[model samples]
Target: MEEIWFAINDIPMDVLSRLPVKTLLGLKCVSKDWHRLISERSFIRHQLKRAEPVSGFFFQERFQWCDDDIKAISYIPVKMEGSEVQHSVFNFLPESVVLSAVSNGLICCRSCFPSPQPVIYVCNPLNKEWVTFPWSTPDKRSSLGLAFDPFKDPIDKSTDFKVVTIHQTASDMEVEDEDKDSYLTFDIYSSKTRTWHRSREMCHCHHSLFKNKGIFVGGALYWLTDGDQILMFDVQNELSWLVTVPIPLVQFDSIPEMCIGESEGKLHYVLISEGGLHVWVLEDYLDFTWELKYSISLDEMEKENTEFLCNIQQRVESRMAVDTTPWMDPLAFKDSLLFMRVAARIYLFNFETRKLEELCTLSMLGPNSIISPIVLPYSMSLIPLG
Candidate 1:
């Protein structure tokens, strides 16, 4: 039976690469040659080229009560065709987890709370696999970012990634007049060498809070600086630069409801203001050019927005008043949809249809629990972190 099946199932490499990672792993046990074929490095590269499309989003949800805490991580698909669905939770992550960053398919997490020392972890939410890196020394409060581009380095074909901790750049520093030349330093951990290295000092107001606003594209990570410019980091070279920010509309709020995300391999800047939302795409990184995409009026969105706010208000205790501000945050950018997050609900806005649908909700959290949610665009991969 094995011989007959092998003869009939000699599939092409492209076809084999398109199979889900779970299926590919299972098929490895079918036969010896099958196992060898799947294990080849060249084969894995092809698999990444034809990687399974992103099916949904992975989020870190915190459910906190007066005395108890539950850190739940879950994945929610963009579409809901079933009767009712819930998030796929993974219990491997540590309690009181803070999801720092996500790139490619790996999620960067850190354990927070109570302890003076915190440990960082990288995980693939798809396969529910995780790797904990060594923290050579105890760390104070710092922001971290992850960078991964398997095909970035032309000289080396091997897949690797790095975790960057902007440990030295503090938002508020009391620099004495005599020490103005001293700057903040960066610490990086390379997966290739499986070690950490402290690099050169950066002379800028890093305001590492930019860490939360990071978006990776074309071998680099870009973060919004305090509205005046953008902080760009070259992950491979471990260097940083500043680029002037393109303010799409002058009427944009002081701190507009905005987000930076990538779509179709290009960086897009979006902000909501004066009942209108607009988008700007970074045309050329070197030239620092930006082209406007669209400025949409909220006239069509009022109904959907109202419904969404009402939905959440109905669930929350009447005593817990909802924010009366008319606003929604752009969480992510996809081909056909925009992820708009408000309160504890995430809604998918269809660009073509101009309609809003609740993508996912943090309902399982206790009635008394204070919820904090972080939703990120996720695409699962088969790459090994070892």
Candidate 2:
């Protein structure tokens, strides 16, 4: 009976869909026929649905004050209990590689020094499998982002994953005084082809000017422009569209910076002020209508006198306060975990329960170290840790 099953030319699709992805991959090693069946795009996708789901967040810590000049990588299991938070270090990153973005169990890094030619590296920290792609242009300072779409065209019968690079021309010090026609261009890199292609025209007003930052959602990338308009770059079709985001009642000139993040699987925009944090939910991406969801201010917190505060006061008295404005970058974590950094400390604000929790304090590891954490599975996965 086993020999007869092994010799069969075809297997039932229904049966194949029921097996786990690892089991299917193991069976592919049995024979060339099994390999063809398991590797087929359709069968691989079916098996993927049966695979174990990965945890939500992989928290990493970097010591910017350390003299060794090395950054460490680590993982934080998702939905960890308050007492289970661990500080496990993974490995040291080589001097040439700098961490760029994290997505779908993959962490993307790039070379440190600027060159006419650049190469981007993608690695799975869990598996340690790395792939490097050549980025030929050097005059353009580029930002890298990772995106995954199950519905995109299958590559070799497998779902497609993309690495997008937003390329902008280097600014010229001399041209700032004379040239007004300076503009930036964008290009995208595909993992399937291992090549770069010019993206279709994006919103000229937004993409060309403020193209440095964007948020990934539903296989498309979104960015904010000078006028508070949201611009989207569709990964599948390589086209661009504009979305309207509702503005607050505050004066336009008072809003200093605009950043995009994901919460509860929906796109949200964060507005920062010396007063506190304001979060707006996007009801419709196409129309850009936003509803004010949450707001937190530091005025209510009790203040304590500290050496750092005294130092800041000294600087302010000396007319050096221009360099010390209090600003923060807000991040949305899974389970409605909203985080923001305040002078080496991390604050977590819960949206569902309307509670504020200070997670941990961060100390400077060095002058160059940076921390960026993003929420995962933005759709149907925004719950607080149990």
- Candidate models: Cα lDDT each: 0.62, 0.51
Q: Tell me the tens digit of each residue's lDDT in model 2 across 215-268.
A: 566667765555556667777777776676566424432333345666555777
Candidate 1 local Cα displacement, residue 210, angstroms:
4.8
The residue-by-residue lDDT of candidate 1 on 16-72, one tens digit each, is: 888876678898898888778776766776777664555666565444334222355
**With candidate 2 superimposed using the best TM-score fit, by how many Å does residue 153's alpha carbon deviate from the native?**
5.2
Superposed model 1: Cα runs more than 4 Å off:
1-10, 19-41, 61-70, 83-88, 93-96, 136-140, 153-159, 168-184, 201-203, 206-212, 248-250, 253-255, 302-326, 334-336, 352-355, 362-372
Best by lDDT: 1
lDDT at 225, model 1:
47
Off by over 4 Å in 2: 1-96, 114-117, 138-140, 151-159, 170-179, 202-214, 224-230, 241-245, 248-258, 274-276, 296-323, 331-335, 364-386
